[model samples]
Target: MPANPTLYAYLRGEILPYDQAFLHVSDLSIQRGYGIFDFLKVENGQPLFMEHYLDRFYHSAQLMELAIPLERSALQEAVFHLIDKNNLPLSGIKMILTGGYSLDGYQPVEPNLMIVQQPVTMPTQEQLQKGFEIITHEYVRDIPAAKTINYSVGIKLLSQIKAAGADDVLYHQGCVVSEFPRANFFIVKQDDTVVTAAQDVLKGITRKNVLEIAGRTFKAEEGTITLQDIDQAKEAFLTSTTKRVMPVVKMDGYAIGDGTPGPVTLALLEELLKLEKHSAQR
Candidate 1:
């Protein structure tokens, strides 16, 4: 067992105190917001879907032309090492690929990779049982396909979203819903068909797994979901690494269906919990 009282962070080739990890101001991630990251959940000190997360991480890096310094095996070793060092029971591991510090601040230097683990705080059971609310925005992200660290548009609209009595923002192009700020959005129709955006979304890990799980039992449609669809949805939900599967009660002042967690959403949530429960063993 590791005995460090402080948390450990991997920065490039060094593993040090989490607080001691630093990035230069000239780093493209800081100066130009050029970086990508992927998050995986840790349960019983075991990181779940690490390979899937890494595959997406590397894909995101490639899409951004960001070079990751360490190989996948080495990065996996580092993650487990960090987990052992911290000795946390349940947590989240976030892997970041930064465009390294440049002297001129405009050019991309060699990329830097960092791995850090933090305690996981899942959404409340009440929120899951009763469901949550969200507001919609008419905006699209730059490089929507890549999981870059640029969430300025999402973060900037936080206040407005909160003031509207909503938890997060669902982005859309015209009448079509794309995704939430940090989660993938989905809708279950009266006919029991699942619908979400296809082209302009992050294609989240949890989203992918949920599709696989739900597709086994329901019609999983990876296509456009319109605002009218939201209004007519029998149930709605969001998926993320930390959030898991959560029911969406309302969106943009419209009460989704009966404004409560529907049967399909609950069933999917149960399936998601099962997936999480066995992820460590796998």
Candidate 2:
């Protein structure tokens, strides 16, 4: 047998070396790009909001019609085991369910489950305060509720985003704002109401927490936000597992408010950090 590897992955009912985790080429995920995934952050040896992530993961599997072989409890146990084995304190865990090997290479079979751990670094104060810019695109995701592995459109626009001097792309449909590629978008109205899209967007875990935190101090609502609404907005920001609360200073070459990280955005970030610390303790 080979020697023990440094990193490990939970794949197909086994904890194996990260490099050894493999899926057959005949898998529908490879042939038809059929799969779903959910990612969550781990801090100080604890998985943050694991229950919520698991809930979404299972929901995505159900939507994709991929049956996860492991029970919820068993999956949770495997996740913990993988984390303990890898021993990465500040990291992110990715849970993936892929359409398994198919006889015709186009049909779904027994799904393959994979859990991987990778190191993660939080944004520095300078990076957070500087904020970022986003270019707008007039497109919406198919099956927006499920967290699938389909990112072809977003990935294809990388060149356009870089050419436009932006960090990411904000998706919209018929002038109605939706979400970013991997993040949820929120805009603060002139009246201090924080609004995010209510329909046709993935309900992100970070987005959920931000809405809850913002509601305590502001009028937070899940409703339609349009390009026109953004034009009259006071400030804007995004939330994701990696980007907890990142201010959006510019959109399509115009400044959002004063073109800097707004006070409300900064305050929410602080509260989110505190909440995360408390969560780690629990």
Candidate 3:
């Protein structure tokens, strides 16, 4: 990880030294677990899909009723300023809005906003070539539509998932596939149809773009994906800001398709990388 003592962060309305950006223990986000945050990548000192992420951040805050103390324009300025201040060639930027410190450590108060810039490494090409397996847990997020700062159920299963030789958890209710802990899930049918769950999903930015790419290159559908459907899938993959497009080789203990990255999976990855390159250049 890249680290510099000179890195700056935005706290509330003030730009401060990174180490000085601290919150009171009694803040609602700390005491009552009330907060909303969004993270996206920066390439060549430019943030990608920042406007889309910021829109989701505001909507998440609205869903939790945790008011953000800054307007969109002000928040954007703060984020850009921090990026310039940090100046990491590649990084992941997180924008957070917390329900303010409460006198009783319960009720909401004026919110605290923060922009944290951190150096990050993209997933390795070797990891993608070998692909990764994911385990399914019978769980669903509290609010599937909102990107709120709550990951209790997902993170709690970290040990269980890792022990199973998996990279992540795909949450489902009964036999119907919903989504992964932090990413969107998709599977290709025997007939090469790309299908992903539309409802009960976080609607990730990477997911949105992949669906568009699939529509142009292959047949794409958004609907219910059951375990039975997965069993019959020719390919499977997960999408997220960090992972981009990741092939899923196995589910539970069963090998998906031929236990290798399928043609459709590779094609989408290639196109997505091209898109990423274009974004980086611009």
Candidate 4:
């Protein structure tokens, strides 16, 4: 494995090394995976859609009935502090809030907020131009709307996904396609109709922006989608904070359309890249 560069973490009002921050083992998050987290990107010290990510984090914490120990303003300031402390030019930020220490298992107290930064590399130009393939598996996300720490199902399928000679996996329950392991899925048709799974998956910030940008050019519907529907579409793609609008050339053992990144997928990706660039400038 490659050596991950050391970065700073903001815990409460103190700044510490990423690996030194510690949490108790008796927290509900440790015993029952009762925690919420958010991922945001920092470009040239600017956090992209930071407020949106924080809003989602607040919502998720509320859903889990976990009270964040720090105020929103404080949290934002901490993130900026860490960014400056690390002297990071560009990086991905992950904020993890777990229910903090307790005397007994299954009990909760205040939440633990950890902000970490790491250098990242995006997919190659060839992978972006040609798109990537994925396999479909039978798995469902529990409380998929909340970005929780538990990822057992996704973890178990990692080997299967790799063995299929693909980039990732899309999960399906019966005929209804749920989502990818870490991204949302979308399908486009020859008639220019775009279909995607509704609120059952993560409300990805990037996914929302791409849909808003492409809504003028394509007809998008948010609803239940089937594996057969994916196979029938002219093109398919996955969206997330890290991958943005990633084209999906194949699903399961079947090729999407002609087994190539379709025109519509490429167009949306181009528009998304422009949006990303503009966002970074702000």
Highest TM-score scorer: 2
Model 1 residue-pair collision total? 0
Clashes of 2: 0
Q: Tens-digit lDDT track for model 4 on 1-282? A: 232447777765578877776666776677878788898988888888888899999988988888887899988888888778887777888888887776676677777778888876666778887788898788788888888887888889889878988889888888898788788998887798877788568888877887787787988778888877876788889988888878888777788888888888788888887877777523
Candidate 2 residues lying further than 4 Å off, grouped into runs, are: 1-5
Displacement of the residue 67 alpha carbon in candidate 3, Å: 2.0
Q: Candidate 3's residue-wise lDDT over 8-104, tens digit each?
A: 8889789988877889898888898888899989987888877788889988989988888888888888888888888899898998888888888
lDDT, model 2, position 224: 98
Q: Which candidate achieves the best lDDT against the true structure?
A: 2
Between 2 and 4, whose lDDT is larger?
2
Task: Give the lowest summed-lDDT range of ten residues in model 3.
Answer: 273-282
Candidate 3 C-alpha error for residue 174, in Å: 0.7
Q: What local lDDT score does residue 25 receive in model 2, on the 0 to 100 scale?
A: 90
TM-score per candidate, chains pooled: 0.96, 0.97, 0.96, 0.94
Model 1 error, position 87 (Å): 1.1
lDDT of each candidate versus the true structure: 0.88, 0.91, 0.87, 0.81
- Among residues 3 or more apart in sequence or in different chains, the pairs in candidate 1 whose N, CA or C atoms overlap within 3 Å are none
On lDDT, the stronger of 2 and 3 is 2
Listed per candidate, the RMSD to the true structure in angstroms reads: 2.6, 2.3, 1.8, 1.9
Candidate 2 residue-wise lDDT, 1-282, digit = tens: 333468898888889998798888997888988999999999878999899999999999999899989999999899888888888879999999999888898888899899888888888889798998999998889889999999999999999999998999999999999999899999999989999999899999999999999999999999999999988899999999999999999999999998999999999999998888877513
Model 3 score (lDDT): 0.87
TM-score of 1: 0.96
